[model samples]
Target: MNTEVPRLSVVVPVFNEQDVLPLFVERIRPVLDELGLTYEVVAVDDGSRDATPVVLGLLRRRWPQLRVVRLRRNSGHQSALAAGLRRARGQYLVSIDVDLQDPPEVIGDMLRLAQREGLDVVHGVRADRSSDSVFKRWTASLYYRLIQRMAGAAIPRHAGDFRLLSRTAVDALVALPEHLPVYRLLVPWLGLPSGEITYTRAPRAAGRSKYPVAKMIRLALDSIVGFSAAPLRVATWLGLIGIGICAVLAGAGVTAHLSGTTVPGWTSLLVALLFLGALQLLCLGLLGEYVARIFTSLQGRPAYVVAFDSATDAEPAEDALCRL
Candidate 1:
């Protein structure tokens, strides 16, 4: 790590954010400059179906320090972030969303904490999130609690991709091989000394949020199952409990029959059958998740394939280095 390099690489993953890019870049550049730090802005185009790429090209034309990386297909947010991390060339790396809800000015606070506190990672936490609707906020809170319970990680409630990482932390994260790594979970797995800077998340400036409720729910499920075995264990307990319930019911029915108090059993049997069937489906789904992850790992598939490289990076070509 070059401590004196004095360069901060700010990576923003864009997916159809053309309308907001201009404002994001304008607000961010000035804040970056105010930190007295040399920086490069990397905009990862995650196969935007809009005019995002054209707008990114316009920015690159205006500023030499602005760089754009274009992916051939829409790899999800995690993949886009992985690509940006691979291309980042700086002593410190800051990754955030293009929506700008995290605020650009917080970068200075993160940098100060990193340097003064000697922390390897600095995650920005939302001190108060009154801007979000009640349902959204409640779901967000529930998602974090569920992940913490299942993953047993200290991932903060409101932290997203808006964080600063030291050179070592960046390298460590990129070295990880999980195809669907939830960075929110991996940060704690790496066990780096870290601190947080509190800030209020701002509302979207334009172009609706990329993540709707469905996407948010899916992401939350992926994070919990990807990082921990608790889901499978819960499935096991559910299956066992279901069996126990059926056994007790059977015993009760047999006892009633022996006592000559037998009643028509169709309704009771039908209800038990339906309940057990649903339980079986839940268990199967959980098992399938683990099996799928293991099967993919055993198949030795690469996490991502670089369709093309527009910029040179320090590491060897990913194709040359990929062991999986």
Candidate 2:
């Protein structure tokens, strides 16, 4: 490892991305090289089941500027990113993914903008996501809109994890006590001098997307529960509505009995009972989600465990020494 701190550290969290690693390196290395800044690429392997670890090992051997940090298990992408951020030793840290959907070339723009404006954070916002599938675009729009309504902070409309942070910003993020942090919300909550750079998001260069419907839903839940009390409030509203409906039904039953037209109907009564029961259950589930997060947080577990770090075993070399 270089004893001297680098000017920039580009952190990429990897899962089963064996096929895309080479292509990512091919595209990003040149951008860093042309910038003429001392930099290191810190790729955190989030316990890939494929040959990603082996590929990273070989890449590190040839590309001395590359450093690999392997996690003990698959702890998800955000956790892996947190690991990289904590390990980064640079004046500025840039976090991007290996899929190349968020263009690596934009890093130059982010760096320039940050330096020019004296900003602590530079977010790469997707100006156009026409390249993505219709479903992806729709869900992304909904997620951002929902977060804006519920979260206590204002997250950029179309920003993902592709962002640049100064040392101060990185330190603030790393110091946060969240075990499953939603960086999009947490970063904005920090109240830093941040700017945005617009880019047309490109399609993935290789391999399948890691985030599927289930994972996306999980991410949304984590973000909502971690950063807002809206779910609990919604639960409260549901309970109130259920009570009001029950009272209305009781009043109708009393009026019918007084008028000598009380119809004995088990079906309607059963339906109303079932509906209220279901609503109560749903409210309880929502409260449980928040309670679960609180319980997990109090456990004080590390987000990810690193099995290996290439920097500890390898010597550092000049930036962008290896080329495709």
Candidate 3:
């Protein structure tokens, strides 16, 4: 095992990407090799249920620089990425997906920009995403706009998890107490000196996308709730609006009764009840989202459990976790 610190570490969080793993390795390996840097690719397998483990093992044998960290269960993408980031052993760390959407070729440019300009972080922004579906592009646009509005525009427009971070930036991120961090927002919120590298997003090399509509919605909720208290404030406003509406309804009812103009108020009463009920539910749901986060934090559970790590199995548990 090479105990010396490498110049770069690429942290790849992969799920069931058996079909694309080889293709990713073929493309990414050569690019890193050409850089002439002693680097390691930390591939964190997020409890894949397919032949992904087998493929990674085979790839590791051929490419000694490739290290595999297998999680005990299917933790989400961000958790897997966090695991890789914690485990990566390099001076400079780059996080990218195995789907090949973000080109590996631009990595060299990112490193150069970081070195030349003394940037602590380099974001890989999608200059063009023509390959995405119309619905996807529209939703992505809305997601970014909404988040940028709440979290501020310090975050680049089209950047995702594909970015480079200096050791300092990585250490800062790992030091944060958040267990389920939305890195898209958290990284920018760190207020580190950063730059962006634009790349045309490509279609996946192989396999189905791990993120579906449900997961995307979950991610949006996490990003919002984790960063801002705007949801709770919105809930407060809603409750106030509900109270105002009820007050107006009550005054109108009293006037009708006093004037002896009251007939059957059943319809109006039912409508008011339904409206109030919906508002109450909405407020509870928003509050519940926040309460859930607090509960998770209190539990103090690690987001992922490492079943095995090819390179760091011999290292002490504390050192391996990078919690020190």
lDDT, candidate 3, at 304: 95
Q: Which scores better on lDDT, 1 or 3?
A: 3
Error of 1 at 279 (Å): 0.7
The C-alpha RMSD of each candidate to the native structure, in angstroms, is 5.7, 3.5, 4.6
What is the alpha-carbon lDDT of model 1 when measured against the actual structure? 0.83
For each candidate, the alpha-carbon lDDT, in order, equals 0.83, 0.90, 0.91
Candidate 2's displacement at residue 130, Å, is 0.8
lDDT for model 3: 0.91
Misplaced by over 4 Å in model 2 are 313-324
Pairs that collide, model 2: none
Q: Which stretches of candidate 1 lie over 4 Å from their true place?
A: 1-6, 307-310, 313-324
Across residues 1-324, which tens digit of lDDT does each residue of candidate 3 receive? 669899999999989999999999999999999999999999998999998887887787789899989999999999998998898878999999999999999999999999999999999999999999998999999999999887664878989999999999999999998878889898999999999999999999999999999999999999999999988999999999999999998899899999999899588878998999999999999999999989999998889999889885764343234432
| lDDT of residue 187 for candidate 1 | 84
> Model 3 compared with the native: what TM-score?
0.95
**Full candidate order by TM-score, most accurate first:** 2, 3, 1
- lDDT: worst 10-residue window of model 2: 315-324
lDDT of 1 by residue, 104-134 (tens): 9999989999999999999989888888889
Q: Judged by lDDT relative to the true structure, which candidate is superior, 2 or 3?
A: 3
Model 3 Cα shift for residue 145 (angstroms): 1.5
